[model samples]
Target: SIKEKPSSKAEKEDENPGTVRILLLGAAESGKTTLLSQIRMLYKQTFTESELIHRRAYVYNHIVSSMKAILAFASANDLQLSLDNQQRAKEILSIEECLGPFTQQEYDAIENLWKDPAVQEAYKKRGNFNLNDSAK
Candidate 1:
């Protein structure tokens, strides 16, 4: 085997920089878009800042933005549940899953569930999330 020596600043500069990739997923108006904006801005990256800010502003103006309070409540409850994990991110969620792709039964169940007093109470107490373990 050949020995390799560490490089100096000029040598390091000759090499290309590493790349990082992130993926965002959510419904329309979810903060996936907003978060991406904040990330690019906070990084002070060499990109089109005005365009990004304009798009983020448009999302806020025309779409539902992130909810701060209900999300905090849900995070607190989830923390209390002791789900400490590094493999996955800590999430503040919404119940878009409950609506699913919409079978007739799921659609009817959704309409009925929305009117449920208990469901409303749960939403207020915790963040909106589907409690049902199995979703089709």
Candidate 2:
């Protein structure tokens, strides 16, 4: 673990200061968040339950959004879903953004859609569109 150094005004006046600052820059899923989480752990900065809950909600929301994007791409590219999964895709797209965390049925629908060949094809070209890191 890296420890923070305590410095006085006199230290600030010194040729070399004790304080160090780091700047992180990256695109999505490029490990920026992972690095920050590791740094927070090293500094004993634990996330609360409420924060974890919010992260869970974020994951759920990401699933919904990713599915929607994949479905739209499939439609635009003439990728056809199976008869069963076509209905599932429609249900996924119809989901309201603020409907909250997914229910079991909704989760099942998402899982099934994810397994669809048409959705998988669109997912392969996910880089062409803007999707969440969690979507991967």
Candidate 3:
């Protein structure tokens, strides 16, 4: 059996008056925008049926614009947050409110995806130390 959140839908919302921030650290082009948009669509809800659909669409656009980066946590990578997980979703948004926006690359790096060889190699190259002490 699945567990449920204690708060009602109206109890928590994007405009509830709190700040949230997410630190997305990634190399580059890791589909950060897509992930965020997907998250926004996932938690979206409205009491009425029409509101549900419209609100969901509205949520999608808002997320895309803001490009919510809270969904990139390594833990959340495997498990998606659906409408049933509204509580977590709200928390993420609330956090992002304070943290501000971050790019997909930001997410990947923050999530430690930079461990990849390519990223490591590139980083090494960028930060290479040409120690020519002996020649002196």
| Highest-scoring model, lDDT | 2
Which should have the higher TM-score, number 1 or number 2? 2
Tens digits of per-residue lDDT for model 3 on 30-62?
A: 556456657667868225776456646644444
Task: Write down the TM-score for model 1.
Answer: 0.28
TM-score for each of the candidates: 0.28, 0.69, 0.20
Candidate 2's residue-wise lDDT over 1-136, tens digit each? 9965647765555535654557899976688767987998998989999878876776777778888888888899899999999888888888777336777888888888888898888899888777665686
Candidate 2 TM-score versus the reference: 0.69
lDDT of 1 by residue, 1-136 (tens): 9855647865555454664566798975466866886887798865577775665555332211122232344455653322221111122123232211434543454444434443344455542453321111
Which ranges of candidate 1 are over 4 A from the true structure?
1-17, 46-136
**CA-lDDT, candidates in order:** 0.42, 0.80, 0.41
Worst 10 residues of 1 by lDDT: 81-90
Deviation from native of the Cα of residue 33 in model 3, angstroms: 1.1
User: Which model is ahead, 1 or 2, in terms of lDDT?
Assistant: 2
Give RMSD to native, each candidate. 15.0, 7.2, 21.4
Best by TM-score: 2
Q: Which pairs in model 1 have colliding backbones?
A: none
